[model samples]
Target: MTQPDFSQRLHGIIPPVVTPLKPDFTVDESALRRVIRHLLDSGVHGLFLLGSTSEVVFMDAPARREVLRIAVDEVAGRVPLLAGVIDPTTDRVIAHARDALAAGVDGLVVTAPFYTRTSQAEIAEHFRAIRVAVDLPIMAYDIPVCVNVKLERSTLKQLRREGLIEGLKDSSGDDTNFRLLARECAEDPDFRLFTGSELMVDTAFLVGAHGCVPGLGNVDPAAYVALYDAAMREDWTEARRLQERLIRVFNIVFQGTPRTSAGASGVGGFKTALKLLGIIEHHHMHRPNLPLNDEETVRVAEILRAEGLLPAQERKLVPGV
Candidate 1:
């Protein structure tokens, strides 16, 4: 397959797709394909697999491999497939990277080493080692909340200067650092900068971000695609309007339901919303993470109905009725 021109094709709304699972905790392949089709048909720019939204941390090796394999096959080179190699160390991440590449992912998304405190120097070395191990394009995933180590501006600038990474997905939620990175990398046409913050996509665009990898995009991709288009057209008013609506949809991420704890709510909310929309078969969370119970599922349906995502008829069949 021909490589996508990352400089152009990589920019826009790319959803970090959820891993659809069966009750037995195995990947539900057909449902996974259906979700992919929904996103693609909704005009998403790309597909990101096995990221935080994908429950990568909870998936075993075989499950992760299957997710990547199915995503690559289902995507079929229509859009770039970015597979996450988020592990606790260099070697483990490299192993995932190798598998992702073998499964035909166009690039790899890697985060800083977790489960141990790491220095900026160590993080830089971690990315460097991965670059040496894999020939695929690399995008630094700077989600400090999950990874613990923020990819410092100086470190990223140095890596960019050395051509060690082709892109960055900043989920750090630190706008100051994100703007600094954007300004420093502005001149490089190939250096893509993506924000994973659903709430701040419009802000990211104004400050030179190329696109977004919003987890919320998994639930309502067309909204994000519209926002990106508006931003690209420099229509701030339209972009802001779309973003505000999207923020409303994003509220489902933290429904404050009793069935879901705050820690698990985001993923649980996404999976439940997908199931309610009929985009996937089930909303089963990966092991150790609880799925949204019946009450929470009904709450998700109501939110979808409020957002015009669900038909009125379906909305009437509320949970516990």
Candidate 2:
């Protein structure tokens, strides 16, 4: 096969799509394709599967490959598809990377291992090895909150110097790091940098970052697309306004859910909001994570309605318009 035209291959609203599961907790291939088509129809630039938002960490190897195949097939050249290569072990990550490439994915997004914190040097070595093992373009995921190792500016530079990594998705939610990266890799235009934080979409655009890979885009690809379009047109006001609305939706879905003694995480909230929007069959969460309660669901609906995202009296129309 020929080399992928990376310049033409990346950029814009790449949502880390949610992995829809059936009641039996098996991968729902049909629903997965539906979601991908929905995002593309809504105008996302690319599709991302098995990323952090996809609950990839909980998936085994077979399940991972199946999702990748589903993504590659469903996308069907209408848009590029990328898959997560985040594994706690280096060998597994290498294997997964090879598999993703062999499956004909456009690129790979690899997260630093979270189990047992590895030193910066060790982390650097890990990425370098995988870069050599796979021929696909790699985007390093720097979500320090989950993965203990933060992708240091110096380490990123070193990896670039060694020709091991091509891009980065910074979830550190730090503006300083973004500005530093823009200056450091200023010459390498193909060295893409994406903001993983949904809230920082505007800021990242301002700092010369290529685009975003937000989880929220799984539900609201329109908002992110509008934001990116606004940025390209230099419409800062409209861009910020759209971004704020997305932040509001995120806040409601993430916080309205009640917490258990173990403390609440927002994966359930995200899925619940999707269910409310009729995007998924049910707000089915994988094992060990609970679904949203009735109260949270009502609140999420209220927020969506107030935001005018769902049908209201004004936007409402008779059947078939």
Candidate whose TM-score is highest: 1
Residue lDDT tens for model 1, 136-214: 8888899888877788888888888877888899999999889988888778867899999999999999999988999
Please provide, for model 2 over 1-321, each residue's C-alpha lDDT reduced to its tens digit, 9 standing for 90 to 100: 223376456889899898888888889888887888889999999888888778888898899999988888888877778789988978899999988987888888887767878888888888888888888777788888787768899888888778777788888877898899988888988788888888989988987888898887877888899999999988999999998888887765465334631213356666666766777776666776766667666666677778776666432211210
Q: For every candidate structure, what is the RMSD over all alpha carbons to the true structure, in angstroms?
A: 1.9, 4.0
Regions of model 1 farther than 4 Å from truth: 1-4, 256-259, 316-321
lDDT comparing candidate 2 with the true structure: 0.79
Report the lDDT of model 1 for residue 217: 90
Q: State the lDDT at 31 in candidate 1.
A: 94
- The candidate maximizing lDDT is 1
TM-score of 1: 0.95
TM-scores for every predicted model: 0.95, 0.92
- Give residue 46's lDDT in candidate 1 (0 to 100): 94
Supply candidate 1's per-residue lDDT for 156: 85
